[model samples]
Target: MTARTFQATNPATGQPLAPAFPVTTPQEMEALVAAARGAARAFAASTPTQRADFLNAAAAAIEARADAFVEAAMAEAGLPEPRLRGEVGRTANQLRLFAGVAADGSWVDARIDHADPARKPPKPDVRSLRVPLGPVAVFGASNFPLAFSVAGGDTASALAAGCPVVVKAHPAHPATSKLAAEAIRAAAQQCGLPAGVFGIVYEDGHELGVQLVQHPDIHAVGFTGSRAGGLALVAAAQAREVPIPVYAEMSSVNPSVFTAAALEANGAALAKGLAASISGSGGQLCTQPGLLFVPVGEAGDAFLNDVAAKLDATPACTLLTGGILNAFQKGAAGHLKAAGVQPLTQGAKPDSGAQPQLLSVPIAQFTPELADEVFGPLSVAVRYDRLEEVTPLLAGLEGQLTATLHATDAELDGLADLLHVMGTRAGRLVLNGFPTGVEVGHAMVHGGPFPATSDGGASTSVGSRAITRFARLRAYQDFPDRALPPELQEANPYGIWRLVDGERTR
Candidate 1:
C-alpha cells in the first residue's frame, strides 16, 4: 500500500497550507539514493566551470521565483516578510558564492610533491586534490525554511563540491521545501547535469531517516535540529555496516557573558541588547542566548528589571509547530518553578505562540541541568559574584555554536580566565554583540563540539569551508602527468594557486 500524504499547517493561524506531500515508500527512497549514486560519478567528474554554472542556475531559479518561495516559507514558518526575504537573499547569495568557489577552483586544495629519484631511498612523485565523497543526505531544519532547507548551505556546498544531494524535507514546511527542491531540480536539468544530481524525499518519520542513513550509497549526512534528533541520526549513521560522518548542528544555548565593567558601563543597554537577540524569529535560533551571565550587585538587579520591561513589551513569537509551542510552554513553566530560579517576566501562557520569559538564577544554584537550552524567545540571567566562578560556570557548558561577551575596554584585561574558558566551549565567540545573526562569509563558523555538532572539529556547515565536508583528498602516486586531475597538473590549467613541494605556486 502507498504511504499517507501530509499537509502543512500555518503556525500563526493554525491553518493548513495547500498541496499535500506523499511519504515515499522504503523502496522509493532506495530508488532515490540509487539514482544519486548513479549520477555521482558524472557529477563528481564535471569540470569546475560546469559545476559553477550549475550553482548559478539554481540561484537564478530561486531568485526568479522569489515571491512564491517567500510566500510558502512565510505561510508555513510564520516568519515576517523581511526575515524570509532576507533568508532568500542569503540563500541565493551563498549559492552564488559556491558558484564562485567552483569557478575559482581553489576548493580542490591541491598539492604536488615532486619525485626525488636520486635519493638513498627513492621518493615517488605524488599529487593530490580534494574529490567529492559521493552522495550525501541532508536534513532540512524547521527554523530556517529557506536558508537551512532544501537549497540551503548543505545542498549548495555539497553540490558545489560535486556530490549529489538527497534532502529530507522537514515536515513543518513541506511546501517551502518542495518549492526550493523544484528550483534545484530545474537548475540541475538546465545545466545538463545528470539525473538525481539533486533529490528530496518527503516524510519526516524516523524510519525514513533510518532508511536513508542505512543506505549503502549515502556517504555522509548533514542535519540541523534538536539534540535528541541529531543524536538519533548520529546513532543511525554509526549503526550502518560502514559508518558515515553525520555533520549535525544540534543544541546550543549560546551563553552571553556581561563583564563587570560592561554591566557597570551600560547595564540598561546590555539588557536591551540581550532582548534584541531573543526577540528575533521568536527566539527559535540555534544561537539564541539561552543563558546570560551577570555580575552580582545593583547593576545586575537593574539589568534584570530592564530585561523584565523589555520582555513585557516584546510580542509573542509564533513557533513553527504546535508541538514546539507546547514544549516551549512546558519548559518555561518548569524552569520558572525550579528552585533558585526567580521568575522576572512571564509573558503569557502558551497557546498559538510563545510569550517571552526571563528568569534569574544565582551561581550557587546554577548546574548543568539549568543551562539546557529552552529553544524559544526566553532568556535566563545567571548571577555570579566572583570572577573566579565565571570559568567554572562556562566549563560546565555543553558544546555551543556561540558564546558572546559584552565587555568594555576597561574589562578586557581582567577577562583572561573567561576568555580561555569560552574558547573551548563554542565555535564562534562574539564580543559586544549578539549571536543571532550568522554571516555567510569565509570567516564564519556555524559548528561546535559534541552536542553543538556531531563532529565540529572536522567540518563546518556554513560558508565556503562547508564544501570540504562533502569532499576528501585524493592522492595520485607515480601517475602520468596527464592522468593527474586538472587542479594538480603540472601546467596548473585552472591558474589557481596551490602548494607545490611545501611552497605555494600558481
Candidate 2:
C-alpha cells in the first residue's frame, strides 16, 4: 500500500501549500531509530572540537539558505517577513552558542580525586565526567519553526553533547524543518560524522511521536508545545519498559504584577508596553503575559483604559494555524462567560484571523480558569484592592516560566515577600518589564516547574546548560590514566576546568 502524505497550510490564505510531505511509517521510523543507534557510539566518541566544528558548519549552512527558510516559514506560519527572518537568525545563533559550549570542554563537569594510601581505608583514585546519552528524539514546535524546531536549541544542544538526533518535523512547517534538517546533515557530512548522526521524519499525528519515544535505543526526548502535548509525550515516555527523560517545555501564563506606585508613576507607559507584549506575534509566545494584577483605583482604571485603546488600535493577524485560531476563540469565549469577567476592548476582528482581546475581572472573582493561557492576543487584568492580595494570588498560580513585577525602587523593599513568592512560582523573574522576550544565554532559564516543563524546572531547553540534559555522568574508578577519557585523565589534556579534591581548578 502507498504511504500517506500531508500538506502544510498557508494560514494567511486558508489554503494548503504545494509539495505534499510523505508521512513516516512505523517501518521507516524503526529504521531511523536503528540508524541513530548504530551511529551513537561513533558520534559520542568524537572529540568536543569535532562536534563544535559540525555545529558551526550547521549554522553557516542554515545562514546560507536563510531566505528560503524565511519564505517558507512566512507562508506556513503566517508570520511576517521580519519576524520570520529574525527567527532564522535566532536559530543560527543558538547553533553557534552550542558550538561554543561544545568547544569549551568545561561543560562536562569533570572531577578527579587522588588515592590516599595512608588512610585506614585506602582511597582509590576516581575520575568522572559527563558522557552522551546516545540517540535523542526531538519533536519540533509549531510556533517556533526555527528557534525551537528542527536544528533549533534542542537539536544543537543534543548534538553538542555528542548524541545522535532524530527530529520529528512539525506538521505546521514541514518545509522549514526539512531545510534545517538538510543543513545539519550537510554539516555532519562535512565534519566526517556518521550519516545517522542526524535525521528527520515527517508525520502529522501522535502515533509516530509516541513510537519514537518508546524506542529502546532512543535515550532521551526533547519537546516544545502545549501542556496537553507535553504531558502526553511525558506519559508515553514513562510507560516505556525503560523510560527516558523528556525535556518538554509546555504552557505558561507568565503573570505580571503592577504595584500601585509603579502604576501611578508610569500608568500610560506600562499600559503601552503591556499591550505591545500581549499583541506581538499574535500573542503566540510562550512567555506572553496572560494574567495581570493591577491596583483597583483611578491609576489602574487609567492604565486599563490606555491598554484598551492600544489594543483597539492593533490589527488582527493570521494565526499559525486555523485550529490555533479556533482554540483562541474558544478560550476567549470561555473567559468571557466566567463569573465577573467582562470584555474591556478587542482588536479588529477579520473574517478569518485572531484579534487582540483585553478582559477585566475583580480579584475576588478570580478563578483558576482565569489564569489559563488563551494562546493568542488575549489577556486578563485582575483588579486588586491592596498589594497584599497579590502575594497569595501569585502563590496560588501554577509553576510558570516567568513572573514579572512592575514596582518602583522605593516599593521593592516593601514588596520583598511578594517577590519571594514570585521566585518560588516561576523559573525566571522580571522586574518592571514584560516576559514576552526570552534571552538566549548562559543565564537564561526557559524551563519552569510542573506544567511549564515536564522536568519540574530542573532543566533548561535553552542556553549552554541545555547540553547537560542529553548527557549522563560516568565515573572511572582505579582506571589507568591511559584508559581514561582525555577530559578525566591525570594529564588534563583538554586543559579545561575541573574539580580536584573538592576544589575547582584548571
Candidate 3:
C-alpha cells in the first residue's frame, strides 16, 4: 500500500507549496523517538560552551535564510513581510539569549555543601546541578510560524538545556517549518552534535501529536495553541508510564482596564492604541486585548465612541487559515446574537480578510461569554456604572497572560482593589501600554494560568527560564571534588553563582 502524505497551501491564494512529506506511521514514530533518546546521552554530556556554539550557529543559519522564510510564511501563513521579519528576529534573539545562558552557566542552578563531618547525623558532601531530562517533543504553533516553529524558543531552550528535541511541524505552514528545521539540522551537523539531536515530523495526523507525548523517551513537551489542543497533549503525556512537564501556552482574552481618570486624561490615545491592538496581526496574538473594562459617565462616552470610529476606519487583514477565520467570525456573530450586546461598529467584512469589529455590553448584562477570545480584529467593551461593579467583573475573569491598566499616577491609589485583582489573575501587567507585542528578554513572561496555559504557567516557554523546563536536578552525595560537574565544583571554575552552605556564592 502507498504511504499517506501531507500538503501545505498558501492561505491567501490556496496554492500548493513545495516539499510534500509522507505521513510518519506509528512504527516510524517509535523509531524516531528511539533515535532521539540515543542522541540525548551524548548531547547532554557535551559542555555548555559546546551547546552554546550550536545555538549561535543555528541562529546565524536561520537569519541567513530570512528572505526565503519570509516568502514562504507570506504564502503559507498570510503574514506580512515586516511582521514575519520581526518574528524571525525574535526567534534569533531567543536563540542567542539561550546561548548566553549557557555561556554564563548559572542556568544549571548548582547548589553545593561540603561534608559536615561533625554534624548530628553527619551530612555527607551533597552537590546538585540541573541536568537534561532526556528528549523533548515540541509542537509548532500555527500563528508566529517562524518564532514558534522548528528553530523557535522551545527548540532553542531544549538544546540550551542539553536535551535532544523532535519537533512536530504545524500543518498550516509545513514548507516554512521544513525550511527552519533544515537550518537547525545543518547547525547540528556543523557542531558535530550527535545524530538525531534535532528532528522534525511533517505528518498532518492527530495521532502523531499524541504519540509524541506518550513516547517514553520524550521527557517533556512545549506547545502554543488552543485550550483543547494543549489539554489533549497534557492528558496523553500523563497517561504515559512516566508523565512529564508540559509547558502549553493556550487561551487568554487579555483585558485592558481604563480608569475614569486615565481615560479623561488620554481618552484619544487609549482609543487609538486599543484600535491598533485589536487589529494587530489580525488579532491572532495570544496577548491581544479582546476585552476592555471602562467606567461609565462622560469619560466612557467619549472613549467608546472614539474606539468605534478608529475600528471602523481600519482595513481588513487575513488570518493564518480558513478554520481560524471561520472561528473568529462565529465568535463575533455570537456576541451580536447575545442579549444586551450592541455593535459599536457595524462595518461589513471582506470576502478574504477580517474586518475590525467592536461590540459593547452593559455591566449589568456582562456574562462570561463576553470575555471569550475572538481570534480576529475584534474586541468587546464592558461599561461599568459604579466602582463596585469593577471588582466582581474582574473577579469573574479566568487567569490571563496579561492585564492592562491605563492609569495615571494619581489614579493608581484609587485602584487598590484593581491592582490586587490583576496581580493574581495575570502573568504580566501593563501600565499605560498595549500587550499585542511581547519583548524578548530575561524578564519577559508569555504564559499564565489555566485555561491560559496548563499547570498554571509555573514555567515560561520563552526567554532564559525556558531552558529549565527540559532539565531535571541531580545530586551527588559524598562525591569527591574531582568527580563533580564543573558548575558544582568547590573551585567554581565556571564562575557561576550557586547556593553554597545555605548562602549564594561563586
Top model by TM-score, which number? 2
Which scores higher on lDDT, 1 or 2? 2
Candidate 2 minimal-lDDT segment of 10 residues: 346-355
**Where is model 2 more than 4 Å wrong at Cα?**
347-353
Give all candidates' CA lDDT scores.
0.87, 0.90, 0.86
Query: What is the lDDT ranking, best to worst?
Result: 2, 1, 3
The C-alpha RMSD in Å for every predicted model, in order, reads 1.5, 1.4, 1.7
Which has the higher TM-score value, candidate number 1 or candidate number 3?
Answer: 1
lDDT tens digits, residues 63-163, model 2? 99899998999989989988888888888899999989989889999999998989889999999999999999999998899999998999999999999
- Cα lDDT of model 3 by residue, 22-122, tens digit: 88777877777888988988888888789999999999999999999998899889989999999889888889999999888898989988898899999
User: Which 10 residues in a row give candidate 1 its minimum summed lDDT?
Assistant: 344-353
